[model samples]
Target: MDIISCLPGHVIDRILSYLPIREAVRTSVLSKIWKNKWYTLPNLVFDKHGVSDVASEDSLVDKNKIVKIVDHVLLIHSGPINMFKFTEDDVIGEILVTDMDRWILHLTGRSIKELVLEFLTGEEEEEYYKYKIPWCLFSCQSLHRLTLQWCWLNPPKVFEGFRNLRSLDLNLVTVAQDAFENIVRDTSIVLKNISSRKGN
Candidate 1:
């Protein structure tokens, strides 16, 4: 028996699920049966650096290629994803931000259960330019976990109607300490865990 045929479908799926999205998609070439498996893996991860070969901002062609790959993955994933992760290196630059927001909106509309965003921003006047956390996330009825790293939030507010949120992790995120406390207090019924590392 062929090695690919020997493994059960469920077994293969389980193994693919653990890999980063880029690698998982590549497994589709293994066989026709595996072609659509990546779209239904229940987890979506988008990292520009992970899918690109260029190591620096000097190459615009490489950057565009990476963005297109990400767009293709999101466009094909038709299932309700369990988690969505978007991470980019500090050197990737700002041109990709718009595409990132578009992907976040798409995932949030799918009722993603968990969302993790890690991005870098300029240090000078840091408080003035904060990453915008898509509002759709706050309205996601299925969202239970949220993690934001090296991000900034302006006018941070408690998710007024969210009743399913359970865990929140913030690393190097700039938010009013009092506002953060109030948001937790207001969501006390469903908010069980919170870990934060304040930014400068």
Candidate 2:
């Protein structure tokens, strides 16, 4: 039996948390005791740097494969998904809207505590389209930390703000002044910290 496999489950999870999700999943092949350990990983991150490790830069931005990877993981994952971070470029942002919407809808049901979605849209001068955040995301009461980049925020009418959100980071996001004020100034929602960059 492998000595490392004898570590406590929480310790093993802590070790896995430091690794890229792909590497974390690969640990399942290490031993019987390690098998299925990755299935319950609370944090899932899919980003350009992570994918670049597996494929060339050209194939790294393959949005279809990115969608499939996210879809397949959420489809089979059995436990709670506490954190989900997906960072991709806006090269194919239009086509990925539906997938992004679906992914958020799926994550909301999992009691996601932290959600980060960054769609890099090249330079400041370029007028790339922004992905509008799904209304379902605002309803995720479990969210403690939320980060979004290069996206539009249009919360629905019935939208009450995230009750449990503690930190919010927005970079190059588009939101109506009133809507933004509603989140920050509203008495119902209390955010301990907020960091926002340029907005349009």
Candidate 3:
């Protein structure tokens, strides 16, 4: 009579993987078997508000809470993770950056295969916006897919050790065409595809 029992394991896994990490963790209450199943999911997607619901009009979600959730998930996760996606508002403060760096380092150590970092920038002058990609990501050997959105790179960041990389997507990010070209050209790994769209 269990609802989970009626679903195929792969189907259930796919459904659970799409849920935010917190909601996915909560699924453990369904049953003991379900609890273990959540830990085996190969994809990990995190959003700014995933760990905490509290945010002031001018503040971001708590960084400490995010670190705790990431640590807890990595601690219990079984099997190799396939993807890590992070989406955040562009107004990140100084304190949050430090915690975010730690979290990124943790994921890279796990040999993640795909990484998507999306920063949502509100209506603002292009000249006034800037973003720095954490360097730890460039060292991930297992990373095969990378996506960056609404981000800017100063002095530009170069990606290396991604021998398996096949796809790259950059959307609304400000980088010289040459720098962008250098990234794709240097890879020489038959980049499967590259796509970009201008930011409004």
Candidate order, lDDT descending: 2, 1, 3
Writing each residue's lDDT as its tens digit, candidate 3 over 22-127 gives 8888888887667778788788877854654534454444545565677788788987888877776655556656766776788789888888877666455653
lDDT of 1 by residue, 86-176 (tens): 7766543567667767877888778888888877645645644456665665567687777887665433355554457677777666755
Off by over 4 Å in 3: 1-8, 48-58, 61-64, 122-129, 154-161, 176-178, 186-200
Note the residue pairs that clash in candidate 2.
none
Top candidate by lDDT: 2
- What tens digits encode model 2's per-residue C-alpha lDDT throughout 64-177? 777777787788788899899998754445668889899999999989999998877655555347778888888888888888877778787677677787777777777754
Candidate 1 TM-score to native: 0.79
Instruction: Quote the lDDT for 102 in model 2.
Output: 91
Name the better of 1 and 2 by lDDT: 2
Worst lDDT window (10 residues) for model 1?
191-200
- lDDT values of the candidates? 0.68, 0.76, 0.67
Candidates ranked, most accurate by TM-score first = 2, 1, 3
CA-only RMSD, every prediction: 3.7, 3.0, 4.6
